[model samples]
Target: MKKNFTLIFTLLLCLFYIGGNAQTQFWSDTFEDAGAPSSGSRTASIDFSCGGPPFTSYFTRTLPTGIALQNGSYSLFQGSKIWAAEDIDKGPTCTNASISANQQVTWSGINIAGKTGLSFKGLLAASQLGGWQGLNFGAAEDFLIVEYRIDGGAWTKALAFYSNVPAASPASSNQLYLDTDGDLIGDGAGLTYAFTEYSANITGTGTTLDLRFNCFANASAAQELAVDNFRLFEAPPVVAPTVTTTAATGVGAVKATLGGNVTADGGASVTERGIVWATTANPTTANTKVTNGTGTGSFSAVISSLPAATLVHFRAYAINSSGTSYGSDLTFTTNAALSATTSQSNVFCNGGSNGTATVTASGGVTSYSYSWAPSGGTSATATGLTSGSYTVTITDSESTQITRNFTITQPTAISTATGSQTNVSCNGGTNGSASVSPSGGTPGYTYSWSPS
Candidate 1:
């Protein structure tokens, strides 16, 4: 079998940063306690010009009974106390009191100076009386409007809703009606009283602002509008991407595969992601790095031509509009190259002994363990009788092994002898005889006598 000499090592580079960009809560109210200064109240009369701190007694409207100021089974409102307009307190002659009795709440002098943007989230639902039942009811006259004044400037209508408005009501550039069921009235008898989420982006700038929520019914009786979980937030700065590193895979002595994942892009988009590596700890983009591609998610890259048997640090990283982020640091070392040399001794003759072979290794960890095939013992040198093939295996400290082969051959032997000859007269024929001999070789050797 052919042997492959490639060695592989992997070091995981996890580069990461903690914390992230988050939105700041400028104000929030659950209206669990009507007595709390932050919790606003409802009035039965209309005073369009009345502006004061929330929950303060500044309005002159009679507090109606049907408009429950305490918490109840209303699924729309969060917590205990929800501001609801009901028909429980109607006088013997009262009907659709929300029209004749106006309810309004105000938050005054709110500071929102260098905020990027403003947003609000709340639950809102309107029940209709004397209109189409279920989600199809059309109570176009019932109104809920939100108005805001920046730095005490002229009040501008930010949002408005009319429960009975038709689905095709003319789209107003400044008004947004709640169409929870894609109908004019968001709630009806067929649909149990359930709250729906409402959100809007606050536009325009202000150092000290005033916000108002006003609701009233035009001609319908037994109608109610409930609001809860009101919150105002200041948009935070752009956020950085989140990233994590995966384990590295070694391809060979000098190459490995690095990987990572981008879990989030904070509210911005991720523009770049990949791996970075270096010889020291906490490798960053300033070190050697690879760009897998843009956007958030999993990515991988192959690193090559790395030094052998050296510790390396690496990590995954991602970049977004807010900034760059990295995973934790990881470490790995490459495999060392192995090399060996061998020497062999030949046997003196066929079936003779004294054959030996020795091996030496370099470029590997020290205190190496040695082994020889065919029972040559666990030593660098192997000595025994007869000539044949031999192999030596050496293992380094890291358990990496290298094997070398050597061959011992039989030595060739030679000897010669001159023939003894009787002295013969120059021309005496049969009286002269000569013989020759050879040894240390196969028999039947042929020899030629000199001057013959």
Candidate 2:
């Protein structure tokens, strides 16, 4: 009984191992080991005639120096070798000529079980020798077709290439040349190559896959297509970033400083991160925002031109290739501005000291203090002043003060003078005359004597 139990436990472990391997399945190939065809020789044509489905074909490898001008001189996607359809055909003679029959290369036995998608990358080109003026009459009839099959199903078109077409022509349109170069034969203007990336979504429960690349060419046109760095993998799921909005500080009547932190990037690089604020609740990017550059981590922003004593809502936001994410809402109120007013009374004339100044404070914080320029008490009102400019300063609990100036004018005074007259008879005696005058008042004055 113990032997049977041990055997069952060993089988369970094997099952767990297999399941883990399937979840992490991945495959890739650069075709660098596919030996190059003999000089001036091409592989046999492939027509999917292998009795069943999923037919494979031979691949031709070349070094960067071999096709540098036609294709870029860069090494293969992964190695120094690039794979493509054989360059020369094995028919009548071994020369640099076009193939008499169509040729194809294929990749098979791709296990995509439990996979989400696949991608392929390569470079392709079609050209003829002697420039664009040395091709046969029917050279425009050549083309290359790329197809794929799943679970031995029917082939589906993936990509296609054609020779004898202008470099600027659309892929779906066929370009025709009329031998305008006076060469009497068809030709092409050098070589045109482009790198391409293709992707497809994997559906169903398929476990195996196949891909084919077929090149059709005329008897006089030298056509070629190269593929390199072909890879297959499961697409990762998209996730949004995680961020947090901290409390605000440095609050003022018109500005405040806010802070935020990006805790996680959500499996992707953070492209945009910043803080957003609004006068209402639940702020978003539609409101006032400040960009704090890219990447994750902590950031701070100062919001300016805000209204005084206003309630503001703010939050942190981060964006990645997947989507934008926002942090929790934060609230803060701006400090109120100081508002104070003053009233004054002028002093009386003739050196009278009855001037007064009163200061009234509002808004801002309470617990105010008053100060006078000359010399006075801390009360809001200041009195006993002559005639001149007087200043009073009112300070709030926040240490913010407002100073105002007041003036008191001098008043007019009156004066009179008299001289005793000697009692003298009606005779013309100088000592018997009396004199009186008025001064120390307005220039224009009038007086009347009683008993005149």
- What are the lDDT figures for the candidates, one per model? 0.59, 0.57
Tens digit of per-residue lDDT, candidate 2, span 1-452: 32543454346446644643221225545556554321112232432111111111123555544442332333213356655432334323333332344566667777666555454333344432312212242443445555667889988655544334443222222322223253332243222343233333334447776766665442322334456544444545547989999899877666678878989887678999998889888898889888887788998877776777999899999999889889999998887876767787776555777778777887655678888878657888888877788777878655666787777765567666554566776676555656666555445667676556
Model 2 C-alpha lDDT versus the unseen true structure: 0.57
Worst window of 10 by summed lDDT in candidate 2:
48-57
**How many Å off is the CA of 438 in candidate 2?**
40
Per-model TM-score on C-alpha atoms: 0.51, 0.38
Pairs of colliding residues, candidate 2: 42-88, 132-187, 132-188, 132-189, 135-186, 349-411
Quick one: best lDDT, which candidate? Answer: 1
Runs in model 1 lying further than 4 Å from the true structure: 1-26, 32-104, 113-117, 131-142, 149-159, 163-196, 203-209, 216-226, 234-239, 337-452
Error in Å for residue 252 of model 1: 3.1
